[model samples]
Target: MRDLHSNRPLVWSLFAAFALVTLYMLGVRTLVPPDEGRYAEMAREMFVTGDWVTTRLNGIKYFEKPPLQTWMNALSFSLFGVGEWQARLWTGLCGIGGVFITAYAGSRVFGQRVGLYAGLVLGSCFYWVACSQIDSLDMGLSGMMTIVLCALLLGQREGASARENRNWMLLCWAAMALSVLSKGLIGLMLPGGILVSYTLLTLQWRLWTRLHLVKGLLLFLAVAAPWFILVGLRNPEQPAFFFIHEHWDRFFKTEHHREQVWYVFFVLTAVGMVPWLGMLAQSLWLGAKRAPGVDPRAFRPRLMALVWAVFIIAFFTKSNSKLPGYILPVFPALALLTAIYLDAGSRLARVISAALTALVGAALLATVPFMPGMAGRSTEVALYQGYQPWVLVAGFVSLVGGALALLYARQMKRDLFVLVLAVTGFATTQIMIAGFEPIGKARAGTAMLPAIEAQLAPGTPIYAVGVYEQSMTFYLRRTVTLVAYTDEFSFGLQQQPELAIPTVPQFVERWMADAAAGRRNLAFMREDIYTALQAQGVPLRVVARDARRMVVANDVKQK
Candidate 1:
């Protein structure tokens, strides 16, 4: 009872620390990244237009992904008003929820120490930190996947009491259905694929009989199928494009034309697991040697985690279109595994922890000179900028923490590892926030929206000459018309030669014809194109010229 009481505070402290870190990371940034902006804009558009059926970017059909994330964003916008932070709030909340759920699951599978460690590892993982702060669908899917997986694992532990496990199974189905809603088929496919493979590989057939497969399938379909079916009926073109072209063909035939060699994922995976890679390796190595049936419950959970990690890695590795975030679901599994390994107090675990701490120290030290522009700077620039001084300070703190942790471990300590991991994670989180300063300060193209908006009359007929800026379209909340010259440039000469402007004489004739009809013509052109029009003596005046775009209007007053 005394031991239990002592453990309670430590566990609560770990939870509190992780929660603070997650909140700090989430609170620091505006949605400046590519996908976040796109999603937020889409949601805002949806809310304003009240058209949830089809998604439009720049007022054109954008059927690239399903509507779940958009719907979530729209709902958020409705509740919180349309803003960058509000758009990203749900993802952040999901991320925090994932950390807690993973910890709870870990506690059930192993013990309190393992659970605390798992939560710490997960909350601090660079992948989770970065991905969770954004407005992407991947993190949502990842969170849902973690919850479903934990529920399933916990249900499996109920053992022989079908009634008790039923609720867990039902939760799994519901979570999985949410996953599918979050990111399409892979939510169901990846988890189902991994579980089946693990069961077969480990000869755990009895687990299958316990799963109540029929009821679970019905639940999944009941929850997930409606949206797909409704969306399919509404937009007949989507099913072929999404399931076949995006999923199957993109993987098998390189339809999206993103083919990388298999070893690329190994590099990506290493980078993705940063700061925890050493611990992960040690966990897998130690886990591989555990004799069968020593603790059947422990053995199964670890086995499931291993299979989860392997299956996600393997599945994405075999795909033609590989992205860094594709394997995010594997992080929770790795965290659980690492937590379990850390709890054992093995010499190997301590060595792994020490090595990882050293690497993190080096990394933090390296960031000292670069923090100012580091977040916004390209990778090459960040590296060339060297470490920032404050980053160095953070590094020194982490280094001291890590060294003390190693010393504590040598003396058979546990909490020090958690402390070091938390400190390092906090430092890394700060570094990431510092890195965003330059990007936030840098003038994103959205800055020009007000200028562009001011220039337009109630219906001045806006048109792009040789470019289509999605950011402009998103912020402006209206589609800019695409003129021949601009369309050619945006689509490129090879794919859209028809968009090329005819000769000067031909352009003048067309301009005069439009002018004769009293049409107020405005064309956004490149400076070179504007110069060419002036050279051709087609009476046009520059309305505005930025570094990248030049707005031109026909000189009706001169006429």
Candidate 2:
């Protein structure tokens, strides 16, 4: 095999591409569709309180997820201050790291040409781009797992010395621990299942002999177990409920997120791969035919990659609950396969690449005019909100990028094509951040914070009548009390019955009592609840209203 670093220019080009994608995604404003605002606010809470043990939303106990992501956000906040950009910095860095790791791993396993292709594909992937920009835990987990898998693959193939192998094993365990910190048990579950299945299927069981399994397990347990234990000890119900119901039960039951059949991931996979979908399919087919003849000792990395792709798809497909992001970890393997397939440099490969570039370019071009209107609906801002200039800029950049990609494809210049895609993606993302997002922020629940504030007197108790918006909480800088009007809907009311105020009768009694005492009460209610109150003849005056929420103040003059 050629010396991977001998092609320094190509490697640098790949790095530049990765950097471009990272910057674009990171530069964009925290968008809707994935609850970026909620995650960002939680991080703000973490930074504000400095308490690492328990997670809070709007200053209320929020245990929906573990603390690792919030910790990363808090660290960024401490250094960069609280805002959308700072909140997403860590996720962006992890995304860039994932791209490089994929490239490096490919180079080691399949040579430099393949590594460069792999990096390009991963960097330009739409799903990767979207996930990288958001303040979600999945991207970080996917990136860490990719690095660990690559390290282990390289170790298994090249580590002749015990010390070398041990070092790799330790790195793998560390990555696993970090994955656990990112999203809980599924982190360890997906990677561990893939490795175990690959080892058994490839008859590389003896390789486990070199893994120092006991030490690796101990290390993982030491790092990951303490947090779970402490969190569980602090909240006793968490141990059984989170591990059992949220993890196991949620996987097998549709109680959390139910959708379609098990094989629905095929659609997700295709969509996630986007422009590279055709190439990914070809790569997987090529891998299946060639994987068996490769030496188990020498070609184990490819087999491991296959296992990673297959196991994740299988595991998630079988789960009763599924989301688009759940299949993210499998992408690195698909990327590697696509890179190998593209490395042949055949006329057909170039054509496929050209097609992909054109498709993405077309998609971007089509999105421009609609972008501002789309922003208006999500943000409830006027359709002409200051996003037109940015949208035009993004459109122009996409045209340039598409043209560059076509030029490179015609010239058979793979590196240049990669660079063009990266540049375009970055430019489009920047337009979104600087252009489209301000409109979104103006319409997002965050926009209502000032109005809510104006209505409240100094230290007036604000309450979320039946719903909570994490973004609203962050902006308000205090926890809004939750008043449940129904047993079916009130949050935190089941465990703490004292907080439950079931039925309009209950709500009326509380409001009347508080008002009678000359105390002002402001309630944030969802549209449905406000309507329900109206239907019940509660005489609730709507001080403010929006698509999803309403603010009602009893005795409006009191404030």
Candidate 3:
């Protein structure tokens, strides 16, 4: 056990293996819709259009999010040809980088063992690992917020030199700026709120003096302001929509239709922690308590982490709109606190955590047979059936790993217990995420890409009739005209009215005119819409189809 903990080469090899797996997993799963496909398509448009100043999705102005993620993904596409992995490259790197940063911060503030465990905890966390592989704004935002967090901890910890404090605090501020760029105002607001809560709770008023406020604020603006300025200059409508509608309206009102019960985040926290659930409550409780012999006014990273997790969770819970990913930034803090607790906690707690993992695994194993029953459509039955084997493997691996970890804990093999649990958690998450490929493949509409591509020319008019498959835009390398559909694209459609046919009749009229002109017209629409159009005597020839959607052409003859 001692040798395992102290062996530098083995430790580094584990880190390298974990990193390689994380990067490899980026390409393993197809980009799933609303978030993953939305961002990928946005970046593809940016790369193709060469419009770095303004961000657009589906050839319409999209100001709901700041463009840091888009910019990064677009840059990824530029460097490497556009692909699923390329779209997700930034979020993956951010996730890996966050693990290293947290480890370094934990080593500095807590101890070497705590640092090692902290990295393992975060790197293997089900939620963190899962989000890392999925290309979404939350992971990107969380990654930058992780920097904002660790940098502050490094800067404010006791016994820091003046130069070290200054440099770290500067990094903290700049990261906050990047955080804002990744999401929106919550980037600055959440961290600032957490800091205030920490100060009020711990009475760490003197901590502010070391923040280098003047220099830090300047550095922040320098990194975060130019994009806002250039983008706002180019599109005057962005400022109002982004700052007011995106932030205030989304938070204060239920306009996005994402509201949920108050206990949702709490539930997510419990589930997201997975094998570590046994240690979570105790860790948070202990985190709020000051260590014995520590100075009353000294900087406390544990308390800071507690406040960071609590404040962000509470802040979002108060918002009328909520999502599973909103509380992602809290994972690093939780991992740190959990690591500290495991390093110094009771043997009973360790055993219980390991046992809980085994129980969860067993539970998952029992549910494998019921997976096919959960599918709504008959066609989805095969996908769910294909996924069952993967879940069975994951469950067995977790069950074995957890039992081994429990045995290690009972035998006082502390290092082995942690390593086994970490690897189990990571492997289980990767397995489940990769196992989702069959379902994701259907959702992404990638299977129809070859058929769809064969029907396209340089300027073939493609209409997204009553629906949009977010991934198709990127795969087809072209934008579709919105027909009688405007969910998230409402604002963008408002800006470019000419980009859409707002009503079914209008779309049908346009299709008739295009057919008369002998122009190739392709469309993607729901099965019901296809039926309705067929009933209306529209000249629609099915090019390709899945259970949920269909692709059709205006006429039989190719233009």
Candidate 4:
């Protein structure tokens, strides 16, 4: 019940420990496909190729995303060799930085206590924490979007000096630029839409007058325009594919096959905001209403946050393409609202939230025994079994933390109660994600790295026939020839047809020619494809293989 600000040492120590564990967990698990492996490989190729402007995946020109994440990842690789942690350094920093910025903005807009609570809420949310350690664009984009949100809140709050206003607004502009580079037009589109929604709902038309639109537009264009210009100039086909196909077509068409029912993100948000689920509905409802005696024309930070969250969720919900990560930008807004609500909420509300946490923990414990059943492949049974103990530990941690939270809430120690729940949420998510290493290992095929390395020769042909493990190309420090395999790479292959063989017959002809010339060749294919090739008397000697993939080499003698 003491002033939390007075306990500075405890607060700093808790944050320090959380940060250390998060950094340690960066390298704790293998990079899983298709996002983790795909992004990492793209960065690796950029770093190795020294072609920063043009992003490539497995040596094919890939224009699906802007190169901000790839540029950052490649910079990480240049500084510290290519590895799991290096590949993830940008996203990890973004995640951690998002927490600090949101907390600082909360303090300025609300209060110190509210800021502290906001940071805790965001840092522990399951979706935010899990994405932070993964090598993907979602965390990078979310982190930048967090900057745009926080900077706007700080810049637009009441009683700000002109100098303070301009600086924060500029920072918001720059972050939006980076956000555009991180994912695409959504960076600017999302913020622009949120601001419009907030103005219409709150009638804060004067907000546009103070946004420094002229200066902000200049800064945004400066940061975001060069890459689009240069990449488009160099690759003429990039502009249409990236702008129309990647953004417009992706949003309106279900060709990406990511379509889901309208309520999918509603389900994701409910599950993603664990331990705070009981507080979500109330916080959002409270966020829409202005507090007593606030100026009608003055900025409503809470309402802005509410509008920000709702607009983003609704934007993606209307899209024909829906992925869970698409809705990640809303978490910071949700965190701010939840933090404000909890700081002033009743003890009964706190008790109910804590009770829900404990109940969820118990449910997790009950499901621990059924993990093996979740595996679709026989090879995955042991991997899921290996994950059980971790689930057990996480469940117990959540259960005990929730019990302690209940005790603290009853004693009117709100700070301790929230801290316990935050730590519990963060710890449980980290443990479960780290526990996925066994399954990640199978998908990564990193165990085959050693055998594949031993067979490498300068300029030797390596083909990916019927399948391509994105991570394998990065781990092997080389690109693979694509043979009848172009899923996401279809556009890239169309841009550079010479980069791929185009069909199985072409690959087979090349393989036979290489054998006749006594040259070496290697291929990676699905087990079934390998079996079918063997039935056709293809000359392949198994070099290394696992349950799902096979690495085979030509049986011809090397000259």
Q: List, residue by residue over 457-549, the lDDT tens digit for candidate 3.
A: 898999998898888887788889999899999998888999888999998998999888888799998888889888988889899999778
Model 4 lDDT, residue 14, Cα: 70
lDDT of every predicted structure (CA atoms): 0.70, 0.71, 0.91, 0.90
lDDT of 3: 0.91
Which residue pairs come into collision in candidate 3? Answer: none
RMSD of candidates 1 onward, in order:
5.0, 3.8, 1.1, 1.3
Model 3: residues with Cα > 4 Å off, grouped in runs: 3-5, 557-559
- Using Cα atoms with residue i matched to residue i, what is each candidate's TM-score against the true structure? 0.83, 0.87, 0.98, 0.98
CA lDDT, candidate 1, residue 499? 40
lDDT of 4 at 169: 96
Question: Candidate 4, which ten residues in sequence have the lowest lDDT sum?
Answer: 1-10
Per-residue lDDT of candidate 2, residues 283-386 (tens digit): 77766654546554554666678788988998888888887788888888888888777766354555565566556656656765665565425645454446
User: Roughly what TM-score does model 1 have, to 2 decimal places?
Assistant: 0.83
Sort all candidates by lDDT, best to worst: 3, 4, 2, 1
For residue 517, give model 4's deviation from the true position in Å: 2.4
| Location of the lowest summed lDDT over 10 successive residues in candidate 2 | 485-494
Which candidate ranks first by lDDT, i.e. highest?
3
Tens-place lDDT digits, model 1, residues 344-403: 747656756666776677777876654555444353354324335545765776677667
